[model samples]
Target: MALNDESLQELKAELLDELVKEVPSKTLLSLRLAETRSADIGEILEEMIEDDEELPAALSLLDILSAERAANVLGYLPGESQLEVVGKLDDSQVLKLLEEMGSDERADLFNLLSEDRREALLRRMAHREREDLKRLASYEEGTAGAIMTSDYVSIASGMTVSQAMMRVRQTAPDAETVYQLYILDSDGQLIGTMSLRQLMVARPGAIVDDIMIKDVISTRVDDAQEDVARIVAKYDLLALPVIDVDDRMVGIVTHDDAMDVAESEATEDFHKGMSIGQLEDGVSRVRLWSLYRKRVTWLVLLVFANLFSGAGIAYFEETIAAQVALVFFYRY
Candidate 1:
């Protein structure tokens, strides 16, 4: 059974209490932290921020995790917490964390950095990593390129199932997903695809092209992310391939990222429905003037619309008074 929020909150309290105790059992704290979910840890960190106390202990606990785990947890934290926490990390530690992050997430964090800080950080990364960041960051915020991650497995068409299997095994550790494998041509065009199940059951000597699905479902790099999410949902896909104008495979948008995009789009629509502007953060966190700007424009237009409506009614008053039934019907 899954733990309820109450249980998770209790666990958080226990960890915080341990942090305060004399001779704090680092071993126990470490074990508990390991057992907690990254999202829950992020929530705990958020609570620490809200209290303005226990913040040091929460930050200290973050340092105890491995760079990869820390990065994962950090990704779940709010934007404000992310900047503060990242600022506390040493240069090397920050680099390690960024390297372990998914390309889309790394791009998001990189975009948040100031120009000078971004340049400084870029200098520390390897040539390939720096280039990847630059490419990923170039995409518009709500496009497929902005959400897609490059950590996907791909192989050439001529490779046999045995060879493909070997390649997948070699690359799976670094890939974000391995369930769906892409088959590419020499020119790096996505030619076909195969699921892990098909690969597992096929004869070792069988060529990938023979067993792969030639009808691939993919989205363009510049496609709206909501449209990409619709594709994934419509096809019941685990991952959808992203392509360039030339039909070459660029990256894959995993199901999880698709869902996030869906949620974000829905939230934006919800704001529009309520006559409020689209806001990625909670209303409490938004600047008061910014909120006014989003709403006041619509409100002002509505006032004019109401004024026009009143004017039209006044113009028709004599006609309405002659036939009161017309007024009732029109109002109805």
Candidate 2:
């Protein structure tokens, strides 16, 4: 059943009280609780900004909301206020939030932060998490690897279906999708693949090596993200396996990540064709002059190119006048 407005408000209030009093700040609970809209809670939290010690609490409140919501609220705040909130988050918290965020969304946020802030956040993250983010960030903005998550399920091919199922139960919580399982050889080479349905119906003692499909559709790490999307859409797949140079399963790109890649690629192409570079969401929070500076570089280059086109048109004016009567014939 849907939660009534009054019930949501009461829950929000209880959550807010807990956020203000709980140890370690009940970060996850606050995030889950604020999933329901509570404008009054937002307003109350906004008012606490005036209190010096309340900054952490206010930032925590914003962090608990969805990333898009946080981006929207941050956009509405003044530059100083926005920075104050972002500044309070440590690198680990920022990394956790980014990990939860969609690829384009995370890139947009990363673009907004200063280099020092970005470096600090990366330094604070765990080594594996940091490498994952760096490898993702390194891909061209429109590529598949840039948006794909490293979270996925993989098991050794020698394992029986029952053994794999046990591993899935233990690891599913951290995986982005568990509908498909990737089978890897002993050297961590991706050898085959299996679906949850197949795994479920297979004999408990049957080895994955015997039942898994060896001819799995996969994409290389360097493959264009657009190609990845086309493959997934064409196959109607829930997830696409990602492999490295050695043919090892590095990660799986889930359906949600594929959708985000398509959307981001579309947006970037639109902006580029219009002679505007990609605009990150945080740009809205920056100063008007700064925003103009970001855009004017592209506009200036386009203007100069247009000027050359005008010159060429002027040079052709005499020829056009001489051939004025030819215009109607040309039209035909």
Candidate 3:
């Protein structure tokens, strides 16, 4: 039975009260007993977190929750809390949690994990999921293919609208989005595209070839993600198709994924340019000695460069003293 609004609100209030008391264990037990469904947990947590400032307690409660339950809760948490909870998860747990995340979010999280942890998690993941990750990870970190999802709706040109709808219905649950359908030829080359609205309005006997738009905008597999974002932004596209060397439709870069790529690339570049080490949350939380060690090499190199500049200045001291008036004139 669906939970009534009043009951849900009451349960939420109760949970919040317990959380405020700093009694996480009791709050966790109460939340579990409330029988709040997994699908509803993220929404509930979002509301609770917005109204309450006691996030540490809520995160502690999250630790006791199932992987799916914790994953859902983490998604609703504030950004810092999301990273914190993900950092606390074990490799197996991280893999399971990632399975529930969108491709772009998953890739971002993967980049934050330690190399060994990432490899171990990948090894434990399902074969197909591993393949998808491998394909995506193979792309340069700032490219469109790095962030695009392989899961999309596609149909053959020979299919009737009714047949295409049937296929969509069968695959809808697995698809990231179904607003647009790509039409491919027998060789799996992208030929055209059609929107869900078009499919709905067309006759059942209408062939996809007749409905699909022949002129389509697309990205190459190796295209820079920034360029993809510019193209999408220029055209105001919901998703940009990605094609291989043979013009075979490989996948698509969704708007949300493109946004993530932009954000990740921007963050990484900012850190690099600032001469600061990339601090994956876990890395940031390491011991002071470890943190210092990570930074020492860069500091040493910078120090030597500065020393060279000072020595050059010292070597020209006699020339400077002989031309002291020139120094004043040069300063002017």
RMSD of each: 2.9, 7.7, 8.3
Candidate 3's residue-wise lDDT over 226-258, tens digit each? 899888878888899999889998889988767
Q: What shift in Å separates residue 8 of candidate 1 from its native position after superposition? A: 3.6
Give the TM-scores of the predictions, in the order they appear: 0.88, 0.61, 0.63
User: Which lDDT value does model 3 have at 66?
Assistant: 69
Which sequence of candidate numbers ranks them by TM-score, best first? 1, 3, 2
lDDT of each: 0.87, 0.71, 0.74
Give me the overall lDDT of model 1.
Answer: 0.87
Q: How would you encode candidate 1's per-residue C-alpha lDDT over 1-332 as one tens digit per residue?
A: 34577987898788888887777888888898877788888777777755657777777778778888888888887677788777766677778889988887888888887798788889999999999899989999889999999889999989999999999999999898999999999999999999999999999999999989999999999999989999999999999999999999989999999998898888888888978868867576778888898899889999998899789889999998898888777666
Clashes of each: 0, 1, 0
